[model samples]
Target: MKVLTETWWSAAIGREKTVTVVLPPSYSPVGGPFPVLYLLHGFGGNRNTWLQCANLSAVVDSHRLVLVLPESGRAWFINDARGRRYEDYLVHEVVDHVDAAFNTVPTRDGRAVGGFSMGGAAALYQALLHGDRFSVVASNGGAFEAPLREGDPYEALRGDRNLAIPSTRDHERVWGPAGSEVRRRYDPYSLIRNRDPRHPIEVYLDIGLDDYPRMISMNRRTRDALTAGSVPHEYRERPGGHDWDFVDAGLRDLFAFTQGHLLSA
Candidate 1:
């Protein structure tokens, strides 16, 4: 297996965004291209989260697929109206650059995206909103619709002065606006509501039964919505909590499922 670290830059962010790309044992530029998985990191994490926190390279190399881990910081993988075009930076800039520079198969079928926590939600949003660009998506313990709920942790980071929780609106401010419509756009629950039931993308989601209570409720609601809409998906709940231990344990199952679908692509 070959691991390339911090090789690409993101022009949209105007800074050096670190990334880790892993190539399978037989990877060769002259021989052929391989399917790619864009792995996103959670809040307070960098590109190395997958490598250091979980053994993704070992898992992917065993299957002979390419994996790319991109750093999005705490931006939640969304383009803020405040001027950060992170969504553009990721789907357009990063995907285009990687396909051109590496022996990566650039097609909806050849691509898959997933993440944990905030990153998981981002992956879901990316796949849902841009279904034509991705064939598979998975979210492990993601804040699927946390952006729409009260007492969001992000509010503590925003430092906004006008919000109801002025002292704790800082994080929300950083994410920009708090209107119902804007919140709905980021909320996965709303995505399922607005989109067609037969959306082509395949989605996988699971959160520990003992994690955040609010998120647990939201995931149930999300499952209900999917069922009501007849949207096909995979959902699982197990004994764990919201932490790296639970995520690392969950990765094997999630990766196995993703590998099967992504390889078929």
Candidate 2:
């Protein structure tokens, strides 16, 4: 596999962004167009997280596809009140750049999105919201649960917040304080329920058996929501914790699932 670093301008977020791309050994412009899989990184991670930790290149090498790993920082791939338009950049800017710069099948059927942890959630969330742009999604240990809930007003969090919570400040900054309208719009349950049955978005979600109780519960709730909503998806519970180990496990199979769907492109 061949890996390349790219730095480009993104007006959506009003800043430049760096992306990591991987190409299979047989990749070449002359080889014809190939499908592309876009990968997002979790909170606190940059563009290289999946490549370094998940062995993404090796796992998906045989698939003969293009892998695009774009950095999301702590933004959760959403447009926050702080003016960070990561979601917009991912759906438009990043994808546009890849398709123009690489030998890729530039269509909905040619695209797939996957991520780990916070990114996993972002992957599925973005795919659900923009099904016309992405046809398949694979989330490994995705943080599907919303950080804030209804009735939990953002104004109420002005004083004394719990520091023990994981990235509590970021959650508030990105998703906003509880009861934020964006949260409801981005809510997994609501997104799953709102999906049009006539157009199906293939989904693959998995969480470690040893993940935090909250993580496991949220993933279960999401899986149940998919089942109840009649959204086509594959769910799995594997042995591992919420680390790179868990993300790496069964990754090949997930890639295979992605490959199967990409064939139509």
Candidate 3:
């Protein structure tokens, strides 16, 4: 396995951002470009979070895919109301750089996105909105549902749930007001309800039994919504909490689920 960092100027976020990449053991240009998994961290984490927390390199060495972790700080991996277009920065700018410099498959069939908590939700959000860019999505202990109180923004799109924002309250700063267009745009539930079928995405999500009740309910809600929408997906429950121990325990399953779905590069 090999680890490296790549940095470049992002027009979307209008600044230079860095990402951590883990190359599979068999990595080599002559061996052909490898599939890529764009991994994300939890809230307040950076590119190094996964490595520091989990034995990521050892777990993924046999998977034969490249793992890319983006450095999105407390941004919920969405375009922030504070004028940061993290969504654009990730799907476009960072991807473009990785494809050019690294030997990656660079297409929907060979690409997938996943993450921890905030990152996990972001993975689903990015895939749901830009299905053209990825074919598989995975989340572990993900914050699928936003923490909204009574009388949040009502959904402009179809769904029983509403995500509106009245002010910049914590994550709402990144996701926008509860039901703002921006907020609705990133809501995985609403997006799944109105998913574009042309993409044919495969999804996987799991939550630890000991995780917060809100997280459990949100994951279940997401699973139910996927089932209702007839989207190809899998959901699981494990005995752990919202910590790296849980994430590390499931890395194999996550990689296998992703590997089983991605087309050969």
Candidate 4:
């Protein structure tokens, strides 16, 4: 596998952005094309977080797919009603740029998205709002339901003026007076709450049984909602916590589930 780092200024975010790309082992000139997986990281993480923490390239290389990890700071993959058109950035800017530049199969059936923690929410938000563009999505301990608390950590970060994050908080910086309709639009649980999930997308989520007390209730609520909505999904809880060990082990199952679906598709 080959890893590359690149940057481009995003008009949607009104600033430059960075991303890490992992090329498959069979990325040769004669190879026809490869599917793409857009991976995302949680709050307070950057493009390199997945490669550094998850070892994703090593795990998925056998499939010979391209992985793109974009750095959106802590935007939560939503266009803030106050500012910053982030939803456009991911669906339009980043996806367009990557598809045009790489030998990727640019279609809904050939694409997938997944993320950890805050990133998990972002992945689900992107796939849910743009289900026609992604065939599958996975959320690992992601805050799928607006976090069930007012002023989430991202909101608290928005409140602090002097503390500058590394990648740049476009949502907070661009959308002053954060937490509004924009945030709600990206809430996965809200999208699935009362809606019919006959949508053409498959979803999966998992949280460590020992991670948080709320996880059990949250998963149960989400599963019930999906069941009622007729949304096809897979939900599970295993022994572990919020640490990387749990996430890494869970990823094996995630990749396996996704692989099965992709093949059957």
**List of clashing residue pairs for candidate 3:** 153-164, 163-178, 163-179, 164-177, 164-178, 164-179, 165-177, 165-178, 165-179
What candidate 3 gets wrong by more than 4 Å, as runs, is 147-168
Model 4 misplacement above 4 A: 151-179, 193-199, 263-265
Model 1 agreement with the true structure over 140-241: per-residue lDDT tens digits: 887777466455554443564422222225346435456644466677767766764344777788989887676687777777877776666799999887
lDDT of each: 0.73, 0.80, 0.82, 0.70
lDDT of 2 by residue, 1-265 (tens): 8889888878987778889998888788865789998988777788888776555667767887788999876677887757688889999999999989988998888999998888888888888888878989999888887544433333433454421123456577777777777778688888888875555788998989987677788899999998998888999999987777777777787888888888433
Q: Using lDDT as the measure, which candidate wins?
A: 3
What candidate 1 gets wrong by more than 4 Å, as runs, is 6-9, 152-167, 196-199, 263-265
Model 2 spans > 4 angstroms off = 147-165
Report the lDDT tens digits of candidate 4 across residue range 1-265: 7888767889998888877888878775355767777888776678887776565666777665678888767665667645667678888888888878788777777788888876777787788788767788887876665533443343434555633222223434433333555645655567776343444778888888876565456667777876776778999888886556667877677776666555221
Q: Which residue pairs clash within candidate 2?
A: none
Q: What's the C-alpha lDDT at position 260 in model 4?
A: 58
Error of 1 at 189 (Å): 2.4
State every prediction's TM-score relative to the real structure: 0.86, 0.90, 0.90, 0.82
